[model samples]
Structure formats: structure tokens, C-alpha cells
Target: MKRIWIIGLWIGFTLLCNPIQAQVINKPIVVLDPGHGGVDSGAISINGVLEKDIVLEVGKETIRLNRELFGNSLDIQLTRYKDILFSFDL
Candidate 1:
């Protein structure tokens, strides 16, 4: 539970800070959703940081990594590219 979130945060931060290089390929399509947006902040940290914020960064970082580190081999997309909340008003 907590451990998983912590580890995920660490991995996201690490990948964001330290970049890698790989060959480019365009075949797979990846979609990521940063859970609990808008009014729901999901989990909260001791420092008052919200889980939504953390996961949002992770999602963005995943896209960045795919483009820069992995040479765009993956077509990564996010449910919400911004910090805005998702709505079912479609």
C-alpha cells in the first residue's frame, strides 16, 4: 500500500531526473491515467503533498521518458495532460 506508492514516487522521480537513451520505434500506444484528480487529492503525505499531484508528475514523466529517453518508441498519452479534473459530462 504505502510502500508501493513510495516506491512508485521514487521511480518516477528517478526517471525524471536521470534520463536514458534508446532506439526510437513507433508501434505501441501507451495511455496513462493519474488517478484521483480535481476535488479528490487521493493520498496525502506528511509534507502535505497530494497523491494526485505525485501521480500526475509520474504520468507526465512517463511521457517525457518515452519521447526523450526511449526515442519516442512508445506513443505515450495521458488521460489528462493538465492538472484539470476529468468529467463524465461527455
Candidate 2:
């Protein structure tokens, strides 16, 4: 299933980049950054929930909801796909 999805993504990318395309399809790019990592977790709740974890979860859910409910209109990208601090040099 994952392989199929990857192939589909590759095909889509190729089609989008092809010079024979008739016109450009404009889609809004949305970037969600999950903050805090390494030694920092931002704020911590009484229940031991970290702000970094919360923000990551929120970012993931926002992407899912946008895709499932919004007809996949936006191009969503998540910074630092895993649990890590974001850096321009990284």
C-alpha cells in the first residue's frame, strides 16, 4: 500500500512538472512546524504532557482534517518530520 502511494506521488509530481501541461494549477502551501525538541519541550502540563508533543499532534490532525474534509486543496508540509529541533542548517 505504501509503495502504491509513493508511486502515485511520483506520477503526480511528474505530471505537474511536465512541460506539456496546459496550465498551472495554483494551490496554497501550508507549513506546520512542531516546536521544541532535544532538551526543551516548551510548556509542560500537570499531567506531564509536553507542548512539543501537543503541537506535533495538532499539526498532524490539521493536515488530516484538511485532506479529509477540504478535498486536499492545500499542499501541506510538516517541518522536521520526526521529534527534533528545527534548524536552517540541519
Candidate 3:
């Protein structure tokens, strides 16, 4: 029984330490845009809910779901992880 347990542990450890390879595809990179942020505050609902806040929340959720489904095989990038002001002049 002890020998079986030791072998099981060894097998588990080996699998855990094994590295996973990501599959690459010849496709255009995906750009996620979570728009509206900073002091501007694009739109405000009747309940005082801000559009910027909603957009950011939805964007994060989408990213989480995509990563779970695709694993490390996908190359995903987001424009802004947090609220930030954008200037046209700059």
C-alpha cells in the first residue's frame, strides 16, 4: 500500500511540473477597447450609474471568460486595464 501511494505521488508531481505549450495561429491580433473614462464620464444613467464603470466591468468579465475557454493559447490585449483620460491633442 505504501509503495502504491509513493508511486501515485511521484506521478502527480511529474504531471504538475510538466510545461504546457501554447498553440500559435496566423491571425490578426485582437484589440479590446473599454471606452470612456477619467473626469469626462461619458454618460450617467437616471440612477447615477456611470457608463465608464459599466464598460470597464463588462470588459474585465469578457477577458476572464475568454481566457478560461482558450487557456494560454490566445494572445489577448486590452487598451486600458483601468480608468484613464485620453487626449486627442496628444
Best by TM-score: 2
**Candidate 1 vs candidate 2, TM-score winner:** 2
| Residue pairs in clash, model 3 | none
Q: Once superposed on the true structure, which residue ranges of model 3 sit more than 4 Å away at CA?
A: 1-28
17-88 in candidate 3: lDDT tens per residue? 763411335434677777888886779999999988888888888778777986644555777789886768
Deviation of model 3 at 67, angstroms: 1.3
Q: Which ten residues in a row have the lowest lDDT in candidate 2?
A: 19-28
What TM-score would every model get versus the actual structure? 0.65, 0.66, 0.62
Better of 2 and 3 by TM-score: 2
Evaluate all candidate structures by whole-model CA lDDT and list the values in order.
0.81, 0.81, 0.75
- Per lDDT, the best of the predicted structures is 1
The count of residue-pair clashes in candidate 3 stands at 0
TM-score of 3: 0.62
Clashing pairs in 1: none
Q: Model 3, 40: alpha-carbon shift in Å?
A: 1.8
Candidate 1: C-alpha lDDT: 0.81
Q: Write the per-residue lDDT of candidate 2 for residues 27-57, one digit (tens) a residue.
A: 6788877888656799999999998888888
- lDDT, candidate 1, 1-90, per-residue tens: 999999999988986775542222425778888888888899999999999999999999898888798777787878987667877785
